[model samples]
Target: MIKSGITDSRSFPAVSIHGDLVITGGGLSGVCCAITAARQGLKVVLVQDRPVLGGNASSEVRLWILGATSHMGNNNRWAREGGVVDEILVENTYRNPEGNPVIFDMVLLDKVVKETNITLLLNTAVYAVDKKDMATIQSLHAFCSQNQTTYTLTAPLFCDASGDGVVGFLSGAAFRMGAESQEEFGEKFAPSAVYGELLGHSLYFYSKDTGKPVVFTPPDFALKDITKIPRFKTFNAQESGCKLWWIEYGGRRDTVHDTEEIKWELWKVVYGVWDYIKNSGNFPEAATLTLEWVGAIPGKRESRRFEGDYMMTQQDIVEQRWHEDAVAFGGWSVDLHPADGVFSEKPGCNQWHSKGIYQIPYRSLYSKNIHNLFLGGRIISASHVAFASTRVMATAAYVSQAAGMAAALCIEKNILPADIFNQYHIPSLQQRLLKTGQYIPGLVLQDEQDLVGKAVISASSELLLTAFPGATQVTPLTLSVAQLLPLDKGTVPSFTFQADAQENTVLEVALRSSSKPGNYTPDITLATQHIPVHPGHNVLEIQFPVELETAAYVFITFMKNPLVALHVTEKRVTGILSVFNSVNKAVSNYGRQTPPEDIGMEAFEFWCPQRRPGGQNIAVQCDAGIHRFKAANISNGIDRPTHQPNAWVADWNDPQPQLILTWSQPQQIRYIDLFLDADYDHPMESVLMTHPENVMPFCVRNYRIKDAAGNILADKKDNYQTHNRIYFAALVTTDRLIIELEHPSATVPAAVFAVRCYGGEVGQQL
Candidate 1:
């Protein structure tokens, strides 16, 4: 091609990031696939037509992010567990600040960029495919709307995460759309015979506050019927409620051809449905509720089900069978929109799942005839019957992650996508999935050494793995991501670790399983952590205090899904960010920092305040109330309850995750102490150490502590123990302090009831 004289500033028409794997479409499934592949150490390229990332659930659309968490016993999909789906849930919780959507979008979008490993190209539409044959999809051509440019992309493996299965169709890969006859896939949800009708797409919206109610008028044919949406003789005979009514007949009418027309129809349906909600008087406030959004992009429930090596039928889902090659899990129902085009063939078309969730086989994720091509999102190898449940965004995320990881593997190993199927690489894929924080019960990290790869960047110089700085005998420290540590509040505690050296290196750190005893896989879970150490460390931080019933095994494994995890993460730094003074555990360095220490430091101390001590500042009248630190009594170590007892300020407290006394000083503090003694004459004298053993103490200096309060003093730590106990002690200074605790934290629960000065003094906190 000769260079046209249309001199432009563009360096290149479209430059592919040249990832080992390439995924077209940056929607939920596509994002998952991209991230999964990147995490596995493969270069990944993801292109999306939309400006935003999420296809179904985005702030642009105001769609809710739903998961398997429900107390009402709503039936859930089994294969929906773990993987990208779980990661979203964990993020959604933090995003719903004010328990609302504004924050959710901020977090969700951030996560898409932060969590996954794929290079994302937004506002790029894939126009054509360059597939040589079923086994080899050479390249994809796309037109970028942003700068009005055309480009080509090539990869060893390809994933079609577009809800419509656009690439699958363009590539000449076998695919099916619409509903099948009941006999076709043996899906009870399917029509008795085939027809052009479909279950009509949705145009979901959201609203919270006041705004002018918008109005919409249906077209001449808007009266076309559906079970939920009926045509009335009143107007153009159009009544709205989930209006996919006329959406039947995409067989001869391609979904892409009908996209714009369907998009318009969806708008009418959305406004019409909301009109009913307002006029019906079901919700008076809804009248003022703003039309935050209508599903901007019409989400196709049924599109191309690519024929993989194995096809998962509704029977497999209903039977709750386990496939040796299962990569993702899901459970919603076998919902087939009436293929007859009758919107309301039956009052309700959904066939509720027998259980909340089901295991989805791995074979369905890849093309049977195509070698290096995998499919994620809703277009997997299931017939119309099982897809209704599988089509949801959460389930699709998990599947996409798997597909992305598998695609990455294919690119790296020069293997075809077919080889990444259930029997061949299912275990490896499962392990990889877990590395991205997707969890499956049966799958374990096969090899700790083999699990290391790209996500874990090696460190340049020697840095402590502890949160802050130097470590002392008494400091209780958590994760050590170089200079990053869990903050007291506000921003979520997450950071990316970079390998110090240029050459590839595996990240490694010393970790201990803190799960409690007698529980299923330990409940207190930590945020999904990635290490660029020599090996991947794949396992939840399951913590358990004494009196707690369960704990996960102290497993230290590697991730297998995203193969780049083989490099694992390393926690090493060149210089110290802060120093702690162990002598008096105080804010000596808060004003100025000059490294307040000699080679052998002593008495440099700081104190984190405890409640109402010296019988002043604060007081609790009741003996019944207990200390509830956020990490203390946790369901999964995050959400803590709020209290409003005017006299005493009560922050959300749980006994375990432990109260952080971050110390950012200029020197190392080795001798710090906590004063834990019951107020004998206090009003609630009876409440003396209901669980004294909760008061486990440790020493932390400059390189170890996470605070600038100097240093905290406690003889030793009691990690996880079972005992109804009370705490009563004082921090004492000694040249060389030693205790019989023998690092007791391992066997004892971590709890600290009250921190005051030695004797009856309440000055600085402990």
Candidate 2:
């Protein structure tokens, strides 16, 4: 150990370690940052201050994992986070359905241990940083209490996902704390003037019934009068865990420096509240309930927010602005709280929901001044209002994943984060993220490597005629609804649609193509036709001939004057979906009156019959059973999960589903990556409950891979989860590859998201 700063007055002992990237946090975002970088073959040293990996969601704090889904409520449907967040949620729901905090710890720890490139340092707190120059970090110094050893870790890049932006703060990076003035960012939701007040911290408790009489003894520090608390009216004895997020404090001062004091104050409130429930309870039902646990550490909400190239504002979220460098997306409402917390007479929080998902630009994930510094989680660059929406665990994880990948690319290409976008590597970064199964809203994965995209693509079944037996009656008047129809170069002469008119109505139908291939909704109008319809069930035909340069989606819309009842079928296609929009209604959820329905945020989601795969689509087709859920989705490189139906699935009656890939010439391949459908019926919520099955019913439980020569390459009988990567023993050059799938149950079908193949030499390994 080389000691430099040693004098007669003072001596310091230092130990040195080296890595490519150093992450100073073990929270969800930090864990994801380390895992993503490590997976890309970068040596990462993750130094977490806590004993466990998860920071807020750990046993010590017991905060539930909240994200873009907003607990599957609040109208933000089908927006669960992907990548590492998805993996953790699936594993936890399958293994520990009750949402046990201890089990959750193991799940997080297991994933970190599985990655060989990551060096984890638990109980190590990074408090200081060494800078090489004014713009870059050189090393980090952290103390591990368990080993009583101080570590000096050096790296080329560093990520401050420590929830408070500690590394960046110590390195003298520019940052902002508390709320900004309305004039500064022009955020209408912001305060009139700047202030140091923040969102505060929370500590939760857990309790369960013992089915017997129980007694509680209140400590001396417990508040004797519960009536004095403003939020006491909403307090319930049965409330535990996340339900107690309202019990917060320390927003009036520095949330980080005064955490210990805040923790003590929270303990008093929690115990006092429990005492009110157990002893002062007006009902006898609480006699059998006992306090299971209480958090000793407070889960902080906000502290020092690092400065980035872009500062996301409330206007950006409310307007749903699409950024050119958007690498991740968020949909959670802008949830801001009063600084007084529980002591305040006001409600716990103020929330403003978005009409749809919004983009989080990559520019906000890296430091503005420190060249090699990247920050994520609660500390990313954003105003108090914008941070309110992006501070959730899952959104932060996505940002962390993007930052880690960008760091890897920075090392791989030998450039800075800003240079990545400057050199036109944003597309490359997005492609890598998409290939890895992270869904970026409004972005399509046009995989050039997918051989199917090169050929004349066709499906086994493209037209959906039959609606589910129980269909919802939707009468859309003045509003238009449309579905994406994948059309080839061949002209589609005409298409049929089903509708039940209450009375005589004139229906205007139009065929529109997507303005851009990546966009989901149809923007450019191609043709229009008017059809007179009578009452009762009517099969209307609209003659529309269309030709495309490439195989892409052509949308057909029906506009009803008097709200004609449309029949929705049960079948849903992977890429094809139904969309609706109206110019009549304005956004009404937020408290403040704001202009609504911009051209971009005009599309509104409507619930249709949960159909069989491709069961309700109205399109012109050449074959009878050519299912729209085709093998092409496997190579399309989009994995939007099982619930959204952006995956390939077989017919229910088809006993065996076999997908075969053939090339004109022999191709050498070594790796085959598969993304299966894990049922997303189980929602992410604060309350814990178990689902019927860990794996989805339609998932391919049994599968086998074979070559054209009839040689078995790989097989698995009882498959589970959504992702699998299989590497062959040696490079196998073959023209044809076959994959046969079987359902776990006789009634269920089979499905897959993507099937990616890589080319390499015989000696190559993954």
Candidate 3:
């Protein structure tokens, strides 16, 4: 190599790439979008400004990824976001249970590079856009600072997921910066100017014990006056990283243009906080602690929100409104932080949860002015009130997956993004998304090409829920608890529960269910009964004289009684859980939310399940056994549980559990997709949270597929993912296909959600 002397201004190496789609940003949203599109047969170019992917979820920012599950802090039971994002989360849990930020970076990189159809350009920032017309982008000009190269990327479709809406801004897309007024969208929860119009930026740091005394010296620019922060007294030596999410700033200022200035202020705060912990006499435990990592950039919460065909409003989220063109769903609470951030005297954030998960329309995912531009991440069209709910990484990733799939369809049909919604192509879009394990609220898979619909399905043994053996452990009834039971459109089953009372007292039993059929809010009280208890063990029968109109999940609630203790079992089943009316401070739950009448928010008690190693099932016996887990459920079109248990669960004692599908005639099958249970109830936060197990306990660990002639078609071991697709080199003609499965744990029965088979030429992986 020879060194060249600079003469006139020299340009760096330039490269041009042409693809079917171009995505700006490497956050979870953009990364999932690229993966989804690439898998659907689109050539994609992904441009990320940072050295690593995941944006705020990256090692630099280190914010944990969350979505509808909401840390299992709300009533969204089995409400995890699906498709590519689910895969990423499951993979992270398997590889990095400790939630190491650096390992999470590797997980994202591994997922992106494995997609052969995607060209990932890291450390590349898109600075300019060339438009074919005023309404369409023709190409993008990007520069990679790390490699000193310039790239011109051209694509038929463009998605702006850059967090700041860089591509949308450069392309002249319609956008709004601050919150909308109450009169603008009839959103009573909309904040006033005095309360702050935008959410702020946050920086995080990590601290670790060195096993010895460690001294810290603050920089010259460090914040010397910690007392200036109104909430400085809340900080402690044990809390670090996102636990200090209230340490935010830069909301009143321009979030986009003043990011650098905002970051400096955050740095000063972090160093100052550390200095206070090291030097302040109150935190004696921090003597052995040292700063392990400090974020270089702030995690921005709000920036430019682009305008799409339809703008989501507060009612859409609070009312759980349905959309005919719905392609994705979100369940996180409407969380908004104070604009004054750390310097404010107000509470860190105000969060309001809905009764259930809500659907997101396709019309809100593409630009209104820029014809070829698609919006993803926090930039999707939504009012500030709605954005508070959809801004989380997992929700953004889910919405972006829908955008990516829509882009593939647009390229295949040679149509614009709006045409997909206008021309009645939404049903086809929903079906395609469902086939890939993307759950759209109130929608079931109706694929005509699936061969399982034509087959006769049978299982070795189906689980008949008659009783859960008790005498394992007794939990005090300090908080009201409920057992969720799937029921049919008939008389409600009478439950017999064993409980011990410290003194002679009356136990109140209530039967409740959500007003909506499929939701788990327990908002409607169907019936109530009073049962008398003695000082010793007593068997009590709870009989609800109510009849169900449709299949639903009913809750048998036992009111809190300090004198009573109920028996619980270790046995766990698919699509069944027990919840308590308790508070989880992390999600702002306080047992019951009592807002002022003028806030336009509903007041309700939070009934949520506890994390594993604690959330055991309430032991109960039914007068009549519920036989919903039949062999035919494997072909029911629904993958996850909704109003009822949609899975074919084997008997607890079945030694050789198998699911068989037999066609009338020999069918040539080349692809088989199996949907298993991954415990969707678990939030599986990507960082700073430790999980009880790497794999979900309900998952099928070992499985094998066999043909009519007993030939082993495919064998898998140590499996954890929910959706498993098996591809064959050549089509196998078989009238019968047998699936043998082993339960991951003896306590959890083997279960299969759905089985789909396809014949002929190989198409998309899904």
Residue-level lDDT of model 3, residues 1-766, one tens digit each, is 9999869798899999999999999999999999999999999999999999999999999999999999999999999999999999999999998899999999999999999999999989999999999999999999999999999999999999999999999999999999999999999999989889888899999999999999998899999999989988888999888888999999899999999999999999999988988998789999999999999889999999999999999899978899999999998999988899999999999999988899999999999999999999989999999999999999999999999999999998999899999898899899899999999989999888999999999989999999874346799999999999899998998889989998999999999999976689998999999999999999888779999999999999999998999999999999889999999988889988777787677878899999999988999898698888998988777888899889999998899899999999999998999999998999999999899999999999999999999999999999999999999988889999999999778689999999999987756444
Residues 1-766, model 1: lDDT tens digits: 7776765565646565455777877766777677666656777778888887767555454444433321112212112244444445434442342334345446556766774455667788899988776568899888888888877888777888887888888887888776666667555545444434345544545544545664433345433332255432122212221222333322224565676776676665555555555555555555555554445666555656778877777777655567888776665444445532324334324334333245677788887776667888878887766776677676777778777767766665667777766337667777656444454434533334221111121111111122211221211111121111111222222222222222334334222222322111111334334444333332222211223122222222222222232122111111101111122111122211222232111121121112221101111011222222222121111111111000111121212223332212222222232211111111110110121222212211111112223343433332221111122343232222111112112212222221211222233221
The TM-score that candidate 3 achieves is: 0.99
Report the number of the highest-TM-score candidate: 3
Model 2 poorest 10 in a row by lDDT: 584-593
Best by lDDT: 3
The better candidate by TM-score, 1 or 3, is: 3
Better of 2 and 3 by TM-score: 3
Which tens-of-lDDT digit does each residue in 597-617 have in candidate 2? 431123333222122232244
- Please give the TM-score that candidate 2 achieves against the real structure: 0.81
Candidate 1 total steric clashes = 155
lDDT of each: 0.44, 0.73, 0.93
The candidate 1 region of ten consecutive residues with least summed lDDT is 638-647
**Once model 2 is optimally superposed onto the true structure by TM-score, how far is the C-alpha of residue 226 displaced, in angstroms?**
1.6
The list of candidate 1 runs beyond 4 A from truth reads 1-17, 67-72, 75-80, 97-105, 115-117, 132-134, 194-197, 206-228, 231-256, 273-292, 339-345, 421-423, 446-766
Cα TM-score of candidate 1? 0.54
Order the candidates by lDDT, highest first — what do you get? 3, 2, 1
